[model samples]
Target: MTRCRLCGSTALESVVDLGATPPCESFLAAERLDAPEPTYPLHLRVCTDCWLAQIPPLITPEETFSEYAYFSSYSSSWVEHARVFVEDAAARLGLGEDSFVVEVASNDGYLLRHVVDRGVRCLGVEPSVNVGAAAREAGVPTLTAFLSPETGAAVRAEHGPADLVVANNVYAHIPDVIGFTQGLRALVADDGWVSVEVQHLLTLIEENQYDTIYHEHFQYYTVASAIRALASGGLTLVDVELLPTHGGSLRLWARPEEAAGEPSGRVADVLAREKAAGLQELSGYTEFSARVAKVRRDLLRFLVEAAEEGKTVVGYGAPGKGNTLLNHCGIRPDLLPYTVDRNPYKHGRYTPGTRIPILPPDRIAADRPDYVLVLPWNLRAELVEQLSYVHEWGGRLVFPIPELSIVEVER
Candidate 1:
């Protein structure tokens, strides 16, 4: 962290230091609870030169994603989102039966299944052995490997150049930003489109979504910074869209420099919006730490008051972002008790650092907890509908980020 990862500059400013926490997704088995758990510093810094916000690469991607706890198909909304993206991308790019598609970090074939149904050949380059196996089981041709320059080149040589290279929600996961971007360049055709979706720094600051800051997410991007990162790999930004996923994200359409002419006006419009938000300069980040602190205080106060009043508060999802929020706020089982997730892999495991138990989603209705604190608030709409049954027991849902609010759902 002494120098910026993107620009190699010594001038890096602190956006927020969330103290230290374990790798967010490192859930513990009941047997390992007696063993020591390791933690690392989760500090975010912004480069004044490049305007790319990043954290120290304390843990490698292999350590976090090898076996992998997150499966994208578990979220129904995300699956539908991926489905729509596939159909739209195919139509937009004029893809057909002869077209080929490659998705980097494609988890569990949640997206490429759509490509297969469309009679297009597709390949998923996913690192995690287990999830990649799951993808292959679902009939999506997947290569079990990380998306490095070599891997990308090999895939290109074997399958031929992709007509469309899709990287969704993974651009910030790699520490080696330039190399990863180069891999994207290597996998795509000279004239093919590359679509990358990552969390936008503008929405992160404006909405106080500090919980998304974690070790796995090494870099945060504004369109201005993203353009620089893409250029380092011979890719050029062509279009941009502001998405509501992950609280707020940017879907960047890019291509090799030869084919990437003038970028869309939307890219400039978004960059102007980010500049207006003061992200290009240091002023945008000064008050962020304070806002983050306020979020911590408000959530803790609510949890503590609920505990004191004998009102039970359990967590809704044991997502990686939730671990950051829980560890940062110093919440233990006394405040949260246990959280439930639909993902069966997390069942009977414990959240890293906090050591709160993870249970099945049915446990919530069984226990009738007074309040369910949602960790994955990005899926608020979907979760609200799913958890509406809690209203039968007079239970409410709590969201921690962008200011704390409790919602009452109608059955």
Candidate 2:
């Protein structure tokens, strides 16, 4: 009788278990070196009542992003993605000078910058203090507070309702999914649409993307599950599109539930596909645990053999996803040595469970490692470009996912 995030429905069954994992951004301190890192149950379950998919009830949003270090602008791929999204959303919405755009979790104004350029009034609602400050400094009007029903009401009282709301990759991070969507309901006008991007749960299970599991990610979503979740908060899907971001994701366009439009062919098609794929049945997800177990075995084998061969395997990216992969795989400082990050905040901090020091990208050039273990597999291409200097030394890039192997040429 597991309760669903959308409603208080107790019709959930366990689907996948990613095992015990440490907090993604819980960097260790020198004094706490010997102290044991807190590990939480890393399991994803599907709510049959509401069709929503999420991790077990555990950490809060404040516990996750209040002192967050992973800023969106640090990664070029993400920044470019934001720019493109803003352009497409603006055009699709047919925004004009009078229309307003609001972006939830708009870190460093990566996406809002484009909205601002089109003479469309734009504002950002970001909870993280540091990231919000960065956005304001970039001339993006940002509110530095958490979004709830009260905050949404206060915002509307000041600036009226928004016409376009963008919640990119923030759907999975919200602690109170229903409460957050209710805020969106209050913050947006009747004619407006909210485009939300959540990591696709179908992709996570089907592709064995267990590495994406972490406390920061409160929920993984499928199109069917998301539509149901939004429906609970008085919203309905206007359209939906499958996205390739973060391995696999979905961009859902939803509006107020009252004024229902003709259902998109995309919606019915995916529903039929999921039904054919047995989404409603619990047994369909039972094999996810076994798939995860195999991944753990293959990854450990690769890392151990590489260490024995005297390969200096440095890690790329200090992402939350990378933390889950490293800690779950039991990689310590002996095997990984150090990881490089583009952000200055995490450069000196050590990873949570593994306690491996995080250094700047310059470490790769200085150390001249024989092998670079790309932690954030989605950004492997960017890492390869940034670390092309290593190629001069005949170094190879390794991606440990689906299967473990080294890429000799540019992939």
lDDT of 2 by residue, 216-334 (tens): 88777777788877876788997888878888888888998876587799988877777666776776678888888887788888778888988788988888888888877798988
lDDT by residue for model 1 (187-280), tens: 9999999999999989899999999999999999999999999999999999999999999999999999999999999998998899899998
Model 2 residue 405 lDDT score: 71
lDDT of 2 at 170: 88
The lDDT for every candidate, in the order shown, is: 0.95, 0.82
Q: Candidate 2: lDDT of 98?
A: 92
C-alpha root-mean-square deviation, each candidate: 0.6, 1.7
TM-score of each model, in listed order: 0.99, 0.95
Clashing pairs in 1: none
Specify the highest-lDDT model's number. 1
